[model samples]
Target chain A: MAVLNEKMIENTSLNRKDILWMKIIKQRQLLVLCVPFMIFVLIFNYFPIWGWIMAFQKFVPGKGIFGSEFVGLANFKEAFTDANFINAIRNTLLTSVLKISTSFVSAILLALMLNEVRARLFKRIVQTISYLPYFISWVVAVSIVYMALSPSSGIVNEMLVAMGIIKSPIAFLGEGKYFYGVVAFSNVWKNVGWNAIIYLAAMTGIDPEIYESAIMDGAGRIRRILSVTLPSIMPTIKLMLILNLGNLMNVGFEQVYLLSNPSNIDASRTIDVYIYTYALRSGRLSYGTAIGIFNSTVAITLINICNYISKKIDGYGIF
Target chain B: MEKKRSHDMLSKIGYRRMTAEDLFLDLFIYISLLSLCVITLYPFINTIAYSFNDAIDSVSGGIYLWPREFTLRNYEKILVGNKAISQALFISISRTITGGVLGVFATLCVAYVLSRRDFVFRKVFTPFLVFTMYFSGGLIPTFILMRDLHLINTFWVYILPTMVGAYNIMFMRSYIEGIPDSFTEAAKIDGASEYRILFTIIFPLSLPVVATITLFVAVHQWNAWFDTMIYNGMNPKLSTLQYELQKLLTSALSIAATDTDATLASGDSQKAAVTPMSIRTAMTVISVTPILFVYPFLQKYFIKGLTLGGVKG
Candidate 1:
């Protein structure tokens, strides 16, 4: 680590600016500072890069990525044809879309509703409590889900029965059809409050005078909110949307991994889980890498396209 | 107009206060808010109850509000079985603490350097870090990298891989930016080395974000079972509590949850079988309690850390 830092400054001096080497040497102090972090990124982030080559090779455990014989395009071919791989790509896209939309709309609606609170003390309490679930790990959160949706004795089923919806219980975790909805709803529930945190910060940036002036003009609360509040937070919303678009193919691996079952296999097979199954679980190194590469390619393209479109439409991009 | 307005206000204050408009809105808001709060907290509460309840109650019927049949037997069962749980806890806690410390220090160092206005290479390295955030070496190479470094099944593998967080580094750097650079420059004039300037001056001033990042990293370590799942999945002893419980409970939920005594080896040939529900419940409570205890203490600083970090980083 020290070696890495020293190297950043050894060639550059603190006084020189014209030479790139001198610039580094000149800020030898700061360059030295970047050493440990750079080494870490090198060791952790860069080291694994060799594995991407595995996508083109036929990787075996003992032989590893380097030792494995190159089997060009075989894994990619397999991934394209493999129903599981194709389904995973589709499901991942679907879930990310659902989460982005639900989280976007719900968080705004929830925040708007929250802003109406006259009681400061009450609003603070509500804000804190709502954000608590986002902290729980998937393992803990899923258990709560299991308890709430347990077929014979889940609280949700119990309530549904009491309300005369169904005489029998619905097996939430045991079905394939409800998998998307379950993943989407649980994700929205976990994230809506947390994601709203950003918008809330943005909302504070809105001028109070806008609201006051609207009231002065005898505009009702609804009209002022539609015209002013939404317009003010539009930049934040668009920025968030673009960022969300960037990870369109990377819906979570943990929660879906936790909730997935043989029965729900059709609905819950996302690319992350699929990658885990192939690379981590089954030890199909090349195949997993190929799938991951494909997924990321699609995600990156989608993000770039979205960024361009948004830049054209609204002249804003996170980049 | 002033007299009429004052009289209107006087009349409004006569009862409890308000023109009846504020009162109903307050009730509507409070009720709506209370229900949402219930939705938020209800799941966490149920899991706690499930952890403590008897094994049979978990699978048999519904349990809400409280355990169907209270029992400490399940906890005993898991404890008595594979001494792996105890070892996993110790391993995970130490790994997180040690790893978190190193990651924070390294990240702070990088962030500090980048925060300097005079650093020319900051721009060069900034994009490098962001680029890595967007892309990762596919799994095959990463595994190979770990293998080459002899990181397999070693503690350094965990600590070293996480030694830098560009996101956190960005946050810390931006935060350090807020600190006046004159202090560091003055320290330099006083003949303090760069190391001293970092430790004595910059680090002390960075307590708030540092504390917040600590919570973030610590929580990350606690919540993350994936590392253990990937690196040491085969080594049951090295598996953290979260991963161990996840594996055992998810596969054979009841088998891991049953009481040891209930399934105790008989004088003959019979062996033990864990009761699934109780064991899962016990594991959930055990794993989550320490972290949950930690949240409220760091809540204030941690909350600010995320929002502020998000904006600047």
Candidate 2:
């Protein structure tokens, strides 16, 4: 009786394995469709992780990644102690904070103002014009910025001088003192309309009956906006805040790289620009990789923290 | 009944006389919004005016909404005199078209496969792709990988790494999932293969999403200069328009920073007709014109796409 029971158990286990294999065979076409892309993802996304090991080694270009000397934490040590890297970190955090706050507040304000507009044609025109800058390349946008900020011929300096606000024209992009403001202003200018779209969508989902009840309670326009509109879009506001927080380390590499010069390098060099300069330009491969690792680590940690907070508050996370 | 009630409420609200406070608020909103429009538009208008004005004449610096001395020399200099700019334009156009098409197709295939509930690997592949959205191998490793693959200084660098994005895939998959399974099942019963169903049915039905993704991918490819700056900087033959503009702008900016007087006074007598400022403005206009042309028609679609992604995300 014991032997019979054991044989039956073995037979059932083998049958289960056979059924699994048969199911895979039945979906062979689907496998063929998916496996190539899986391989593509592995090559482009996952395979490069093996090269991250070079951060530990003193990477020599001609010698290849495998043929490098393994130095323990030396590259990271060099990075943390370097003054420029430290400055880059400071600039990165400061600029990111400025950008997040300015862009966030302006977008919400623009959306609220637009929501109050009763004229459809005027609203559409303003919205369309506002989105134009967002679509253009930063190269082109920077060109416009340079032209507008030029001390000699720029419209901004011209207007200021015309108003007798200053004795001489100021080179807005030529000083470190104005770099953060310029970055933040240009960021808000470019993205305010595009960013407001999400908020506007959220506002549309608000119930009209709530507004009616508020009106019945003798609520004024300001009171209606404050109590009804703001609270209604609270979830969206939270989601956007969390999303922005996750990207606190990424301070627009293209904008900073284009904007940075000898004068403003003190304020403009973020970690991305720093990594590019060291890793690719100067060919400090291992050290650059170590810095890159530092950036990715912080970014991932921020994202995970934000995700955790979001899940705790909203019962859902972006990931 | 609901519509009638809302209409009645709106009418009642409309009947209420505008209070002085409401009038003041309305005026404030309108004035602020109009000024915002002016601020957004003034830079582009100034650029256009400068591009049209003669290089030397623009140096006097009173041009605002209109060109002080109009000429076509800046445009002629860029289009006819410069061989590099024209070649870069060609490279930019080709890459935008190729990248846009391939990106959309790859995104569709992945989304379709993932959308299939019965596909055994759907559970595995979805997470595999989505995990990339949160983390990456960072810049150095990716650069080394591209170098090893011999993609440096090649056109393929622009297309391959960006062809299939996790976000695009997720967006497209959610879109495809909205299609009824009955359609695919019926096609299967009629002996249609997966490819046939995708092309004949899914492709036709998913045109809106396809258009949205195509515009997104194309704009990204068009605007991308960093890739060219990094991977193909040495090869002028593969330089993109945006990168060319970047090179011009950087040189102009550096020169402007060091010697403001030299830039205004540096143009030679023979080619003094074209200055760095004029050429820069002309290039900016050229680069931005294509986007402006398509912006109005495609604006609604992208707004919808963003809202959809935001909701699902």
Candidate 3:
């Protein structure tokens, strides 16, 4: 890292205007190396930002962005009034907030528990199993949740019935009331271990001497953890919390889309799914574009707000 | 030695002696971790059990912990002579391999260039990459861009748009930056070109991060279904296993909900024996099996790589 920074200084020392041409000629290989990536980024990443102009247009498929009629916030007005759009925002926020809290708490607890374990092999084994679901796609994760909660052949329903917890099988997936909890729990189950890894890493960063000092002061295991470990990792915890809260608008479209059916659509619709439904399926391109812009704006605002709050509360933030 | 003193201290503190409070804490930790392990694993186990159980008997629903009436019929139907499933699987596997290789190469190229100390473009391009992480053009415009590029519904659609991820490029660049400049500087002094230095020297040293990122890209490509659903849903030949599996499950559920009684009462023995429940479970097992198989072995490297990102952040 130091070498590269030093090299940058050495090469930039040529103040003479004539030497600039020679420097460019000498660095031809590096220039050649950068062209392909620059072209790809320009096309794929930057081009889309230019495409956002469609949000202001009465876009037609063949008319192109240049030919499309400039409507000027008409699409945004429509999106704000649309019931489906409003419902999507509500559901997206509700699900994101629920998932963020549950997963955060579980991950912290899991990390703390893992830290207390004395056996190395046991810790490794536990970690391996915990992160297994992280590798599986939402398609697979939703299917597992689906099969387990199936009203007919599902083991969960069967166990509940046997234990007299319910009079009969409940269609857990079919009910709107249970949708938030189901989505939140399933998201936590899949990501808890993966999230725990960050906390675990943060725990390792805490000085061992602090723990020894606490032990000398006759602090018990739990006491030491409370007094030393938690406070030491508080900065990481705050950073992660702020980062996650910043992404509160993204409720993971795949989970809701896959798990949703006619019975659960009312509860499951989110901004991403709503965009796909309207823009791609119905071809209401301009309205979807407006809503998409709205979604991203809200997310960026939330991130900035959260980062500011974190900076004030703690001394650090992602920015 | 420090270790010996720690060991002595451990014994002195009753860590080895096991006081009642220590014993209680130990027991509590073990039980909690073991239960967590069970909870994490039970869903997979149950899916396997359902896949193996007799479809007809599974509906009565006493099957727990293991299959009651074992059968390979589910596997046979899925694995043998089913053109749709076979095609989807083939497409998925091929795309994962092709996309993984191309993605890694593209990411490595861009990251390597940006990692260069004296590259004038680095200052200009770095912000271009970082800006995308915080904000984007969003769904519709990106879709339109793809349409304009004629990438929609084509095989290139799957591999091209995602070929260079901003996050991956940043991580890879940072990893490369950590490589001492002396190595590349000495090679440059020996008349080595940038490409030669990258491939011969830097690439070999970067195997760990490279492997980690490659596996990540492979897993992502393998599991990806959203793009397939959106861009290429009309093209069956381009369908991935995940997309197919999703279709299979939803269709199966709707069919079961509407025709459960009709199908059962018709008394057609073979159809009755292999219910939609069994087929869905079987498909779930088949699709996830590869990830489950490879995950345990590669988990250590993955954990290290992920934690590296966490700590760096």
lDDT: which candidate is best?
2
Give candidate 3 misplaced runs (Cα > 4 Å). A1-22, A309-319, B1-17, B253-273
lDDT of 1 by residue, A145-244 (tens): 7657766556888899999999887887777777788888888778777777777776666666566667557555566668888899887777778778
After best superposition, candidate 3 residue A110: deviation in angstroms? 0.4
Clashing pairs in model 2? none
Q: Model 2: number of clashes?
A: 0
Cα lDDT tens digits, model 3, B197-306, are 98999899888778878878999999999899888999998998899888877775454234352355347475526776677788888888888877787777667776
- On TM-score, the stronger of 2 and 3 is 2
* CA shift of B200, model 2, Å: 1.1
In candidate 1 chain A, where is summed lDDT lowest over 10 consecutive residues? A10-19
- Work out the TM-score per prediction: 0.87, 0.96, 0.92
* Interface RMSD, per-candidate values to 1 decimal: 5.2, 1.9, 2.4
TM-score of chain A of each: 0.90, 0.94, 0.90
Which pairs of residues clash in candidate 3, taking residues 3 or more apart in a chain or in different chains?
none
Worst-scoring 10-residue span by lDDT in model 1 chain B: B253-262
Better of 1 and 3 by TM-score: 3
